[model samples]
Target: MIARFDYIAAVILFSIGLYALVVKPNLIKKLIGLNIIETSVYLFLIASGDVRLGIYTNQWAASNVIDNPQRAVQGLEPMINPIPSALVLTAIVVSVCVTAIALSVVVKLYQHYGTLDAREIASLKG
Candidate 1:
């Protein structure tokens, strides 16, 4: 039951984010909703990469060596795939950049219209 909590939390967060995005009229709230969705995705990805019972292999130098074929087979403990974790790290950086750009755009929009509501801004633009 405890193991399924991460997925449940992800679902809940995703739904909340979706709801906020669909129901909110404020541009800033919509941006926050997008951030929430991104966070939920990151949580799901990190959960997928989790290995509670796996052995930690810290072979940085050995990874470069092509001669040691036996090293790969020597581990009896299941090794967690490192690619997802690495990808998640990259995603985090990208998410931050996206959020910053989004916030900057929102700032510009607010400056131009003097309002944060999406409906109001649209009406003002027309």
Candidate 2:
């Protein structure tokens, strides 16, 4: 059986991030934790969809991979699915946008309350 240590590492990273997000009182720390969780998800996706060359042969010889386009669709063990990698790319872009928006919100919150603590901010509101 193949070892799934990568998955374990990703899970660990995700757990750490989750702990930080839940335990940290500072908004910045929560944001950092969110990013860490995102990193872990990326790692998981990449690890799950890992593709090693030469393991799976196409209908044609390995040498023809570059030359014959048809060989790509007709493979022996099947080529690695590109969907996960593509999804990861989209996720990365979305994550960056989310982080940027979140940081901007954090800045505004800090400016309004002069503090970065979530508890303090909440108390200040009411």
Candidate 3:
């Protein structure tokens, strides 16, 4: 039986991140929530590669992969599909951009209101 601890942990972390995003009124804390969610997303993506899609083939991957099959004879891609990996890389870069922008906005908001709390932000002078 394949232990799905990674899946369970990722789900739990995602829930925490979602809760933090919803319950936190501080802009910085919300950004932290965003980071948590991003981390969960990356974890999920990595996990997908490891999950068995179950359509095994015997085509050869690289020579080394051919040399070291967990099984024998039949060919397979050996390496999980790289599509998710590439997408995850893109997602990471986009998440970084989002974080940078969020931080910039927080700084501006702080300058304007001298506070980082969501409710306090609206209380500041225009």
Candidate 4:
């Protein structure tokens, strides 16, 4: 049940991001969509790696959060995994670099054409 719910949410997020990416006409809007897509994938990664038990989310507040040993809740029996987290960290940096480069290109394009809309940019292109 938990798995199903998480997957459903992930799918929804990805779908919305995709829609935004495809349906938007402005370059900045498209960039925002790309960011949305990136964030959705990251969220999906973390959720997909969440520990579970018998259809239950086993995640709990750590002692660091509550600061009460007696009332502290144990972490998920199996800590989902760590590889995804590491990969996501790398992906985040890469995405940031990509976005920066893209923005630079877009700025140059705007300077040459003075428009941010994809349709307008295409018309201005020669």
Candidate 5:
């Protein structure tokens, strides 16, 4: 359970974000929730990609294991997985772009409707 603490925290964060996204009536609050959700996903991906190397895969090594040639030769030495990190980086860029676009739209909406409340905007729509 302790070993999987990060996963647990990520789940909790995701739940909080989901609740905020669903229940908030303010556009800005919803955007903040979306950002929180994205952050939880990032945390999950980073935690999942973590590889602990030592006597046991779950146990942390007391010393640096990257220099162990024998383990490397046997394909047992723990190495960093770049795929998740790369994906997270790409996702962050995409998230930023999406958030920027959404914020711009919100600004336009506020200018047109003179309000940022979703319910008000919906009711005012023709």
Candidate 6:
């Protein structure tokens, strides 16, 4: 439980965001919730990629080869995975673009309907 605190926090954040996205009637609130969900996903990905007490690849190699020659011949050293972090970075950029588009749509909707409430906009349309 203690070791997996990040996972727990991510779950909680996701739940809160999901609640806001589903239960809120305001479009802006929904966008905020969506952002929260994205953030939680980012946190989860980063945490999943983390290596406890692990050294960087270069540092590990240098330390083994230079500081401890015998350790170099033993095997590969523990290092944090880079793939998840890289994927998260890509997701963040995509998320920003998506948020920008969503906000623009929301702005248009507000301008047309004079309100940001989803129900109000629907009623106005009908």
lDDT (CA) for every model shown?
0.79, 0.84, 0.78, 0.74, 0.87, 0.84
Task: Put down candidate 2 lDDT per residue, 1-126, tens digits, no spaces.
Answer: 236777888999999999999999999999999999999999999888876555455532345444555766677333567888999999999999999999999999888889998888877763
Q: Which candidate is the best by lDDT?
A: 5
Quality of model 5 by C-alpha lDDT: 0.87
Ordered from best to worst TM-score, the candidate numbers read: 5, 6, 2, 1, 3, 4
Write one digit per residue (lDDT tens) for candidate 6, span 77-105: 44457799999999999999999999999
Per-residue alpha-carbon lDDT of model 3 for 12-118, expressed as tens digits? 89999999998999989989998999999899888887634343433332234444565433544255667889999999999999999989989998887888999
Which of 1 and 5 is the better model by TM-score?
A: 5
- For residues 28-64, write the lDDT of model 5, one tens digit per residue: 9999999999999999998888875563644457645
Candidate 1 stretches greater than 4 Å from native: 54-73
Sequence-dependent TM-score of model 5 = 0.85
Q: Please give the RMSD to the true structure for each candidate, in Å.
A: 6.7, 3.9, 5.3, 4.8, 2.8, 5.4
Model 2: colliding residue pairs? none
In candidate 5, where is summed lDDT lowest over 10 consecutive residues? 55-64
Candidate 2, residue 49: Cα displacement in angstroms equals: 1.5
> Candidate 4 on 71-107: residue-level lDDT in tens?
4236523455778888899999999998999899989
- What local lDDT score does residue 53 receive in model 1, on the 0 to 100 scale? 42
The regions of model 4 sitting more than 4 angstroms off are 53-77
**TM accuracy, model 6:** 0.81
* CA lDDT, candidate 1, residue 34: 87
The clash tally of candidate 3 reads 4
Span of 10 residues, lowest total lDDT, candidate 6? 60-69
lDDT at 124, model 5:
93
TM-scores, each model vs. reference: 0.76, 0.78, 0.76, 0.75, 0.85, 0.81
